[model samples]
Target: MSTVAANAPGAAGGGLEDVAASEASLRRFLHGLPGVDAVGLEARAATLGTRSIKTTAKAYAIDLAISMIDLTTLEGADTHGKVRALCTKGRNPDPTDPSAPRVAAICVYPDMVATAKAALAGTDIQVASVATAFPAGRVALPVKLADTADAVAAGADEIDMVIDRGAFLSGRYLDVFNEIVAVKQACRRADGTAAHLKVIFETGELQTYDNVRRASWLGMLAGADFIKTSTGKVAVNATPPVTLLMLEAVRDFRQQTGVQIGVKPAGGIKTTKDAMKYLVMVNETLGDDWLSPHWFRFGASSLLNDLLMQRQKLTTGRYSGPDYVTVD
Candidate 1:
């Protein structure tokens, strides 16, 4: 029984724009939301992590996690050749086995988007670029928008933009909200369609589970297609409890607004077991609806190699090891 305007892209605090009309109103709306129960959230995530999957189920989860990966290469030394190679691995995580699933996208710096887009041609894989002064939102507003516009023009299918932690932490919620809204608009293309907008909160720096909840709501209200956990450049990127809290925010937001938003847990998720724990949480919290790559994504490089190794073990009953997998 929500009254959200169906056509209002910027509506969510009963109406997002109204909430952002003034910094005071935005603070009231965000703070009015119930506080997070940290102990309860952590216990639930821990319990879900221990849920054992049968062999057959683990195999299926492996493939599903593989398909949901945004095989990323965000190092300072990344070059065009490296990006093309990353795209090739994304197209086939297990080159010896065509039956293996391809990754959802090849995530790279904005400058590398066209190379990735060309390398991934003739495939359904998306080209996701990190923009808006990625990993840090310290730049000015126009700089962020121009960064987004360049990526979109270079053929990025998705734009991952980081929020200004300083603004959010200092209670400048409207500034953060407006930035997300503007970035979403900048994702537009010549065909009138827009690239998917994934807002990165860098949960490690947010300092509290409550802020994670608020950021989730704020991003959704600002027209974010997905709420990502991090940029993978921080000391602590994605953690189960933090990601679980984000999932709850999206679930509640969807219930009140009737709009579905995606969740991405980037950084530190470097193993198949870690990925499985997240998939379990998603299923238990949001059901099978959020299980698809269109609704969920893993922003990792090493995680994909581990998934492929585990897949090989399940199929051939032997370890493929790192030597056999891609160097990423």
Candidate 2:
């Protein structure tokens, strides 16, 4: 709902060229390093677990984007049925009938935007669609903008646009920056309300802490309301370390410009414990200001069930069935 003016005052100017050079240098350093192993994952996970897990009235918001309900492996009718079922019942997966936190939005590809719109018609939940050749973002600029426009016109409340990382990594920072601004411009809603734009950095592809920071700043300066990680389409996706860096970027940006931006760490997050770690990071690193669903979201499909299961465990002292907690 925040309007990020294209010509916002603090827009990255001379510093962008310097940042781009730093990003390239950092990328090369990361590329030369060896791949991480299970030990590293365990160490990081353990370190995060040591942090607090108490739920506040202000819990971190989650965006469960049902990217694909088995694309080629499932029938369209079945997929639609499953999505509808999830929206109708999967939101609150409690057998005891206690209320649960509703997901922030339901994200799907543009083709399913209308279906999602229809399914979530009366609920406060929003409908988000991935446009501009999501997961790759290798399309023409005009076509990408048109894709974003069409999705917004089709009742999408949020638009998740992927950055042209290829261009960015190739040293064309301005091109990538302008592309995001253009797509953001095209996402104005029918009643003149504009859809929130979440720029996916695809951090896995970017591959470094410094480059991630630069990309985060670039996306925010180019009018992104939220800076998201990954599309869940690549071999590597959002991880804790990458998210930690991005959160720092958002925090720094807010301090400098007084503009609060949101962060959505998507992909590879599959458990209540994993979700808790992210929440802990947001709390510790970015402070409580970014704890709300508006400032933070988990772009996940299976995370809700895990959170419910854990909450039930905390209350009833036993893990409930998948049916006991709704899944769609």
Candidate 3:
């Protein structure tokens, strides 16, 4: 089977419709993917999670992990003040120590993009917004497009949109594919640049490893810059086995298509230990090419605080008290 790929950076998405010209063809391609080996996958993920690093390398991994975080706040009560504070923290993760790295982006609702952008003006930190009726993704295509356009207009460097899992689970693969293509279109800016697109699969709801693998391909073919694991609101999000499966998908997709996409495992990744395991999985599965913040991220809020605490432990040779880091 011929593989489909998105265009280069600054290009939103194109030339993928023919690959899924019909529901049958799309279904054929998705279902044709190699089935996942559940037991082997889980065991490997467990083994990778047990990897250890020396004290010096552990500091590097902790810093790298800190830099790859998508500092996020997606609550209904989010305000401009909260968003600004989040941006400040993202720009300077550790206030007392200047060595802490800045997070990749400040993730918030569409309305908070400008505030975040303004707060992080001098920094390279991207402002990412969740659109297309995030977490549920139950809106119509037009509404979803408008939602995406609003974020792009609001100065979001990245748009994290959710796939309509209902359509995907119903075998309406073409509908989901078309929606992603359309959302990619909506991510374009007037200056000919584009906000990077990240497609969220909310894996816990998919019910099987096979579905996760299928969704990963569908999103990439539709031109996602990143294939994300969850909305972080689910009962389960960003587990090691599921993340390993996604890492494998991107690895295979790139080998065939020659275009690299990113992966983000969001939610429930609070501890530095959990973050390190995911980092090890990325390194071992996809290698160092995907190790940077450009390709991998932890969709976390509290995880940064933990990384800060661990960082302090490494530098001071003693654990910081719970009150050491600000509770965001």
TM-score of each: 0.96, 0.80, 0.95
Predicted structure with the largest TM-score when compared to the true one: 1
Q: In candidate 2, which residue pairs clash?
A: 93-326
Candidate 3: segments with Cα more than 4 A from true spot: 1-18
Higher-ranked by lDDT: 2 or 3 = 3
Against the correct fold, how does model 2 do in TM-score?
A: 0.80
**Over the stretch 121-141, how does candidate 2's per-residue lDDT look in tens digits?**
766677778899776878799
List the candidates ranked by lDDT, beginning with the highest: 1, 3, 2
Residues 41-155, model 1: lDDT tens digits: 9999999999987689999999999999998999899999999999999887887999999899899999999999999999999999999998887899999999999999999
- Worst lDDT 10-window in candidate 2: 65-74
Off-target runs (Cα >4 Å) in candidate 2 are 1-49, 54-78
CA RMSD of each candidate after superposition: 3.4, 5.9, 3.7
Against the true structure, candidate 3 has what lDDT?
0.88
lDDT against the true structure, each candidate: 0.89, 0.68, 0.88
Q: Which residue pairs clash in candidate 1?
A: 11-16, 12-16
Question: What's the alpha carbon RMSD for model 1?
Answer: 3.4
Candidate 3 lDDT by residue in tens digits, 56-171? 99999999998899999999999999999898888888889998898988999998898988998988898899999998988788999999999999999899999998999999
